[model samples]
Target: LPDIEGELCRIERVRDVLVRRESELRYMMDDIQLCKEITRLKKELQKLVSIPDKDKLKEDREQEEELLLQINKLVETRDFLVDDAEFERLREREEDREMAASLQSKIPKALAVQGESDHESVI
Candidate 1:
């Protein structure tokens, strides 16, 4: 009987330690997520500020708004985790395509537009 009680006590202690570790891991995950969100927001703000063309900046207003919305949502949701892996993947793909298009348009496309309107349309 004493041996059984000792085993049960040991199991309880192990369970308690596991529970504590799990809680710590949850906090750490939250911290990591928060940091990632902050970094993303900073990068987005930097990009928005660095755009040389007013038209390009205006075109990216919606993206900036979305980024701000995401940041705000992250700030508000203290307990809930929002996974944005899929969204990030899609956004990155779109940005890559836009950059490719923009670069391709810069040479012959700019000369064509030089005769008409001075404002260049951004992808």
Candidate 2:
């Protein structure tokens, strides 16, 4: 009877361990699935956002290059009259460039924050 009881206890311990391991595996599977879903959603979001903006971004870049070329030509000529209006226009363009740069810098930080929030929410 003592040997039988000991065998039964051993079986129960093994059963418990197996049950715990099964639950842990299920949790890991769930985590993997969630990560895959998050990755899919992020890709979809990027596709949606980037597709339309690509053309616009390309156009803007071309325009900026043209503007830079014109500015360089003006500088080379050294005969450009900097009236108040021209000066103001140049200053405004510089400000716009600065603002665009700052916004571009913030975009990655914003995405990082958003990613952190998403991870926290998943947990």
Candidate 3:
């Protein structure tokens, strides 16, 4: 009878230990689920934080496009100015040639008149 009682006591102690261990495992599983939820929330937060960066990048791209357009317009204006300067230079050169031709024709007439006056005085 005493041996049977000892065996029953050992079984009860083992069952108690197993119950305690089961509770500990339940607590650990709950902790694991909480950690997973926290990790998911952190990822969501990171995505939310990056939203502003994405918007800023989009705005920067738009500004860069506007600047490129302005640069192209400036280049076109510069090209027009260069062409106008070349045209003005060509016009001035033509005027100078015309003036030189007129002066040459007048010089020959004046020389012939002087020669005639000299011959009359000599005769």
| lDDT of the candidates, in the order given | 0.69, 0.61, 0.63
The candidate with the higher TM-score, 1 or 3, is 1
Give lDDT tens digits, candidate 1, residues 1-123. Answer: 856975985797678667656755776688698878878897986798677665575658777788888877777664444334345446656866885677677758656776456554431
Stretches > 4 Å off in candidate 2: 52-123
C-alpha lDDT of candidate 3 relative to the true structure: 0.63
Candidate 1: residue 102 lDDT (0-100):
70
lDDT of 2 by residue, 42-115 (tens): 55444445555546566555655565555455443333332433565566568668866976997799789989
Candidate 3 ranges beyond 4 A from true positions: 1-56
For residue 4, what is the lDDT in candidate 3? 94
TM-score of each: 0.52, 0.42, 0.49
Note the residue pairs that clash in candidate 3: none
Runs off by more than 4 Å, candidate 1: 52-56, 79-123
Candidate 2's error at 37, in angstroms? Answer: 0.7
Ranking by lDDT: 1, 3, 2
Error of 2 at 17 (Å): 0.2
**Each candidate: RMSD:** 31.9, 30.0, 49.9
> What is candidate 3's lDDT per residue for 1-123, written digit by digit as tens?
846975985797578667656755665565566456555645544554556654656665565556555545555655665565567557756855885687689779878998999999999
